[model samples]
Target: MRLHHRLKEKVLESVSSVLPITVIVLILSITIAPLTPGALILFIFGAVLLILGMGFFTLGVDMSMIPMGEGIGVQMSKSKTILISLAVCLILGILITVAEPDLQVLANQVPAVPNPVLIFTVAAGVGIFLLLAEVRMLFQIPLSYTLVFFYAIIFLMAFCTPDSFVPVSFDSGGVTTGPVTVPFIMALGIGMASVRSDKNSNSDSFGLIALCSIGPVMAVLLLGIFYHPSETVYAPSEIAVIATTKDAAREFLTGIPHYAGEVTTALLPIILLFLVFQLLFRRFHRHQLLKIVSGLVYTYIGLILFLTGVNVGFMPAGQHIGAAIAQSPYKVLLIPIGMLIGYFIVKAEPAVLVLTKQVEEISNGSISQKSIEHSLSIGIALSVGIAMIRILTGISIMWFLIPGYLISLIMTFFVPQIFTGIAFDSGGVASGPMTATFLLPLAMGACEAVGGNILTDAFGIVAMVAMTPLCTIQLLGLSSRLKEHLPPRQPRAKEEVEDCILYFDAED
Candidate 1:
């Protein structure tokens, strides 16, 4: 029954995402005629795999990762030793981030930068900031104040970094918190908060992702200071045509094993840690262990299938469509196309659904899942629109980011604390793998055609994804606040109450 429910949710979310893309593709094919049949087929195939993979990945997170993260959070907090908890948070943050697929994808695209250095720098940033977040939560520090200090550093670093590196730097922060990171981090927050027997435990549980995001920005900024890549970097525009079953099968098979291996490798350390802790502490029940193990299996299979389909099918189509559109007379249509894709893609984001449902459940349905989804859709729409604008124009990312951060920071003061945390985290969670794989490449292809710097113009799709959610989600939060503060119905007069009771009894 549980499996059936999960499957239903996954299908609903995945269909919501793929249906829009399919509609857009049909419109483009009939009216625009830019996307070839082969490209369209591959894109559809890839979207299926991506959606399925996301579903499986999200399910797996529920089964395995969240439990493990929460277990660790509870255990670490129980120790009440600040240094131990801090070290654990730092190490786990770096380790998990090092394996982030989205960050790996971004690093591969930046030609001038060495992939390893970029990966490590981003991982290190996540590590340090994750540690900071845990500490802040433990100490009951003000989230807004920490955000102000760190963002101030990021802005300062932006000035020192070269023009080419700035967008990627901001983007790294967003990409680092993809599907792999969100479940664990969110669970960790919940777990840590559980240990706090305070009235504001829920509020304190919310801002880890916001803080973790700071790590990558600072790390990349520092990287800019040290490693200046002098060569011109451009992302490739050619699309690989997959015409035969052999091609699709071979491509899918090759990637499936690789991702199977990768997901296993990525998850092994956390699993081992969980085992060790379980042995030493004996916290969880036998049934819980069985459930988590089952979840692990689900996660592994889901990741393998997801990666296989995406790498084999989706990527080539994304590039092709973008290139074809760029060459079209109706090229400006890419903005709307991108916006449509972004809106649907949020539904496909594995963590977004989890976060929304969890929020609704946690808040006792004061915040509805429908409301959360609506806000995220609007947020992503704005992000894609802005990203398309960037691709078309050679606007520096800093122009948008500086103002966006300023607004988010100021809003933090006026809103409820829970809203601020969710808003900030939403920035990272909204971007996820879909934006990294499809939207970023779409921007890059546009940049390639217009003869713009790919890194500066195209790379910040993830940043836009990260930034807009801050505004949109907080706006939702503001709306919720308004609803809460609205005056209640005046007490019924004695005659009115008696009349109502009499009417009710008569109806009965």
Candidate 2:
């Protein structure tokens, strides 16, 4: 009965979460950018899969990821063995990132490095940074100083990196911290911080995701310079030629197994790693182990379905619709349309949910979930607007990134420390699979139409999506900090009342 109840709740939540994007796309199709019958059918079927997939995925994270990360954190921190703890964090980071489905999609797009090489390099970057994040939290290092320093390194590296490699490098940071990584990493931060029992410990729990994000940027930037990865040419996105319902079904049927195999291959490493840890640590009780096992199953199935749907249904639609709009006389409309999609689509990102909920919980409700959602929506909308403009204009991403990061970094010192942490983490979370799948493809199609350099112009949508949140969420913090600093009104005093009464008597 409880199992059924849990599943039902997740299903309902997933539908609500996914419905807005579905409506937005449908509206766009019916009015402005008409979808072919085949694409429409794919969209509808994919929507169903998305709803189901999100339900399972979120619930699975709650069950498996949160507990597992906490357990690992607690045990590692309890030992107070730095070498052992760092090694564990490093291994766990690589293993978990390797399992991220979003990264798979990203890997396929970058042809300069072999898929495995790019994937592993990004994973190593994440692993190293996750290790750094753990160390920073343990030592009580300020998130701002760390971010400013590392990002300086990233920028320096970027100068030498080929134009084609720069966007992909920054984008790797965003996608690496998606659905698979966020929950576990955030929870791990919480668990580790719990061991400290200090005032700053709660704040310390946050910035792991923040720091982990930088590692990928830095890693990819250096690799790009070394490899000198060139522009990747790709065959056009596969369009579904659905003459009938049977063909639509056939496209989806064919797509599912491929994603299923990929998701399974990804999950296997994590499963084996967990089993090894369990054997050595024996941290979880029987009931807990059984529950985690169940959750992993849900996570696997959910990801397979989700990836299959997005790749099959959403990607083709995004490409076709984007090309159509860009080719039309009204090409400039891409900016607003992109903005509209950005505002809604971000809320659907699975990792964004993880970050917001975690922020609210960690802050003890000082940061409300509704406020985070609003901030993220506004930031991402602006980002997509900026990205579309770049796609049309062929501007360097650095034109925006340098100024954006400067503002964010400057605001960091002005806001409360925790807000800075959450803000950076929000940047990472906001650019999950949706940005990779829908928005990136949209930018690519438009880039193709405009005859712009796809690599340099269209590819930084994820990075832009990631950048805006750093500024906006910190602005939320800055706002809250100002409100707290506002002068308090004077209280009514008995002495003042007496003085007033005496003055009245004297006047009389």
The number of the candidate with the highest lDDT is 2
Per-prediction CA RMSD (Å) = 4.2, 3.6
Per-residue CA lDDT of model 1 for 1-508, tens digit only, reads 6786986687666667566766775676667546665666666667677777767777777788889888888888888578988888888898888887777767777778788888888988888888888878877888888888888988988899888777778888888887777888888888889888887788777888898888998998888888876753645535556676556556666677777776776677677767888998998899999989988887877777676666666566666666667778877887888888778768767778768866776677887888888889988888888877887877777788889889988888888888888889888888876676667667777777777777677777888889988988888788878888999889889999999999999999
How many residue-pair clashes does candidate 2 contain? 0
Give the number of the best model, judged by TM-score: 2
lDDT by residue for model 2 (159-219), tens: 9988778888889899888877788888888888888887888788788888888888888
Candidate 2 pairs with clashing backbones: none
What is the RMSD of candidate 1? 4.2
lDDT against the true structure, each candidate? 0.79, 0.86
- lDDT, model 1, position 213: 88
